[model samples]
Target: MRTTPAGGVVLVGVLAWISGVLQLFAGVLMLVAGDHPVTGWLHLLVGLATFPVCLAIFRARVWARIVLSVVFLFEIAAVVFALTDLRFLATPAVTSAVLAVFGLVLLYTPSANASFRQATIDRRNRAATAR
Candidate 1:
């Protein structure tokens, strides 16, 4: 059976994709500017990795929720670190923190929880039927 995606999932997926693209652009720019090659490559790798997670989230995969939760937690921690250092928050950091909080809240909402649970059940049913 086909299931409709929760609004939260869609929102998170879109935001994640946008963030990933921006990260990829920043990585390329950093590389061209000849600064921090390691950081630039790391950013490139992260950007490329986000696509599959976004796709999984869009598909309502259970593992996607876990992955996203971990990612958001890291984003929040990074934001806190930046704040403690009294560093000016860049656009990406600010946006990431905001989106990370919003996404986490959405994911934990009652409707979103139900959607995820239902997706899990559907997947299990499908697997059982296939067997």
Candidate 2:
């Protein structure tokens, strides 16, 4: 049976994708500007990784929620530090971090929780049917 995505899941997934796109752009900009190579590569890796995590989250995978929670938490802390500098207010990193935080919140909502549990049950049923 086909499943419809929950509203919270859709919201969080959109935020996650937006954050990933921002990260990808930041990575490119950093690399081209001869900025910190390590940081640039890290951004690229995170950007690339967010895509699959997003897909999993859309599917209501429990592990994806955990992974993204950690990522968003780190992003929030990073944004907090960056907020100390007024000049950094307009950066994409700040925007992405905000979006991540928003996504993190939605990820744990009641609707999202129900959706996740249902997905788990669906997966189990599918597996049983296949076997």
Candidate 3:
């Protein structure tokens, strides 16, 4: 069990935090536009949720990795579905697809896995010692 997280994990954590911030900003902008109230609120809730998930990822929590993996998978799936409409080269869709791929790759890298495993072991050890 290593004390330091892998570089990839740190990168993923930072990206996750950035994503959360962007979501929050976008949500605020949507609300200011005074339209799409449902979507705006949804973005706000998700943005709020992302902070804790990013924090957990930074702490190398395995559950966070799993949750992020699932989220990325859905992102990719949504992008693919959008592409089915034959708008294959839309900038936003393509960018999101690329980011999702990158995130999945980083989350599943060997070093990231090792970091998560080590963190879990460290946590269990701390709990045992506390008890």
Candidate 4:
């Protein structure tokens, strides 16, 4: 019998998806601005990458959880750097960092761990059965 997934992970996943969508929108805006092509492209790249991570997390993939943790780490770093000079953007930067932290914390809860572990086993079993 499969256990119900923890609510914390589900909330985190939804937040992550919302973040990814926001990034995609921001990337499009930057691209339209046509000031720094590289930055815009990087945003687009990260935003695009976030979708798969979001999907994997909902599916209880452990690696996706790890990847998201690392991503949030980078996000926190980015916000710190941005805060140094971009005072006008401080609100958004801090908000992003806080959400990242929240996601990271939820990703490590006991229920979240069990959900991911079970998913890993299920994935392995399916793979073996297919072979």
Best by lDDT: 2
lDDT of candidate 4 over 9-124, digit per residue (tens): 88888877766665555555555654555544555566577778887787777788888887778666655544453445345445656877888999999989888878778778
Clashing pairs in 4: none
Of the candidates shown, which would achieve the greatest TM-score relative to the real structure? 2
- Per-residue lDDT of model 1, residues 1-131, tens digit only: 76777898888888777766655654565466533565556546666777789889887887988887877676555445334332342355456668777888887888788888888889889999999
Q: Write the per-residue lDDT of candidate 2 for residues 1-131, one digit (tens) a residue.
A: 84556899978977988998887776666566633565556667777778888888877788998988887776665444334432343287778887987898898889888898888899899999999
Worst 10 residues of 1 by lDDT: 81-90
What lDDT score goes with residue 54 in model 3?
Answer: 79
lDDT of each: 0.70, 0.75, 0.66, 0.69
Give candidate 1 misplaced runs (Cα > 4 Å): 32-35, 75-89
When 1 and 2 are scored with TM-score, the better candidate is 2
TM-score of each: 0.76, 0.82, 0.69, 0.75
| Rank ordering of all candidates by lDDT, starting from the highest | 2, 1, 4, 3
Give lDDT tens digits, candidate 3, residues 1-131.
44678899888877766655555554555556534555545446655666787777888888898887776565455444334432433334445456657877898888998888889899899889889
Ranking 2 against 3 by TM-score, winner: 2
Off by over 4 Å in 2: 77-90
TM-score of 1: 0.76
Clashing pairs in 2: none
